[model samples]
Target: MLLGYFSLFASGFIAATLLPASSEVLLLALAQQGYKPLWLWLAATCGNTLGSCVNWYLGKELLRFQHKRWFPISQAQLAKAEIQFNRYGSWSLLLAWLPIVGDPLTLVAGTLRVRFGLFLLLVTLGKGARYALLLFLARQLW
Candidate 1:
């Protein structure tokens, strides 16, 4: 019932974060169990988008702590990330649904001070399309 959808949403949210998770698998499992595909898609998309927003916020905040001994990344590494992100520009947010590099891209967007509205729009489009395609494939296969 609602719990299933909430679980999917939570999974999506966690998956989009730096934390390791896979909302896609949960989504497909729910689809197999006969939950409405459209609702699943919506839940997953919103959750994941919100999660990326959190990453963006963290990216903005991290700059303040880059010189701290507890900061996780080295200055060079941060600069490299900034360079890569700048090379790609804000359009890279459109790939926020990707596996390895996706989460970091969202983070970089915030560090670069990308507009929140644009970040949300691109992230939503990328994440929603991914979930939609997964659901479509689930329907076709099962």
Candidate 2:
């Protein structure tokens, strides 16, 4: 049981980050093993959200560091991200479900000092909807 929970949490965390992991696999495995779907969904969502928060913190720190020499990111990229961030604000987080750009979008939100409550709300909604959709598809396909 503990292993199952850890698997759920770890998969969730990795999924929220830039890493390429599939929490769906974990969910399917757990479900096949007879775990509760509701619990699995909640655990994965919460854990993934927390992991994304870590990325947000890293983005905040990256903005503060501003050491172009040490960091590989170019100033132009940062500036562009800032411009988009300024224009879109937290709403950009809706794209948090997209591939590649999704993880960085969360980081940009923190770098721009977006409101935490709004960030959480949008991230949760986007991520939750994504997982829910995935679950639905899995149910349909399986």
Candidate 3:
């Protein structure tokens, strides 16, 4: 039981970050191993959101310290992301599930000082919907 929870958390965290982890793989593995789907979904969602929040916090800190020189990110890129984030607002987080761009979007949201409450709400909705869709597809295909 504990192992299952740990796996879900790890999967969620890695999925939210720039790493190439797959939460669906872990989810399906756990489900095939007899874990409860509802609990797994909740755990995965909470862990993913927390991981995304970590990225947001890092973005805030980066802006605070002006650490662009040390990081690979350039000011021009950040500026473009900022403009898009500003135009889209928290709804931009809807793309939080997209590959490659999702992680950066979270950071941009924080850098833009998007409302924390709205950020959480949008991230939850986007991430939750993503996992739910994956679950449905898994059921249909597997």
Candidate 4:
């Protein structure tokens, strides 16, 4: 039982990162298997949020290498990204649950030096709501 929850947590964490993975499937499966929805939700949310934090940290670290010729992002591109991110600002974190764009948003949040408290709060709310909705749908359909 605990292992199932741990797997869900791990899936959620990995899914939130740049790595290609999906926690939604595991979450729905666990929910359908009669696991406690609340714990599942909490585990997934916390794990996913923490994974985003990892991206955030990486983004902060990435700036250090900007001066290197090996850096992938050009100064012009980084400047453009910074402008765009600033235009959307912290509110963008609410979409951190979204696929593709979500991971980058967290990374940009760190690059732009968004307050950590705000980042965590918005990320947790977005991810928790997503898991909650999945659990609700699972209960309703099965």
Q: Which is the leading candidate under lDDT?
A: 1
Cα misplacement distance, residue 5 of candidate 1 (Å)? 0.4
Model 2: how far is 18 from its true place, Å? 2.6
How would you encode candidate 1's per-residue C-alpha lDDT over 60-95 as one tens digit per residue? 888998778998899788789889988988888889
**Candidates' TM-scores?**
0.95, 0.87, 0.88, 0.97
Candidate 1: segments with Cα more than 4 A from true spot: none
lDDT of 3: 0.81
Clashing pairs in 1: none
Over the stretch 20-121, how does candidate 3's per-residue lDDT look in tens digits? Answer: 776878887887787776787788888888888988887777776666467767789888878877787778897787888899889877878877888889
Poorly placed runs, candidate 2 (over 4 Å): none
lDDT tens digits, residues 6-75, model 4?
A: 9999999999999989899999988888899999998899899999999999998889999999999998
Off by more than 4 A, model 3? 67-71
For candidate 2, the TM-score is 0.87
Ranking by lDDT: 1, 4, 3, 2
lDDT of 1 at 30: 93
Model 2: per-residue Cα lDDT at residue 50:
83
What is the C-alpha lDDT profile of model 2 across 71-114, one tens digit per residue?
76788998999998878767888768677888889888888887
Residue 93 error for model 4, in Å? 0.2
Worst 10 residues of 3 by lDDT: 64-73
Q: For residue 136, give model 3's deviation from the true position in Å.
A: 2.6
Q: Which residue pairs collide, candidate 4?
A: none
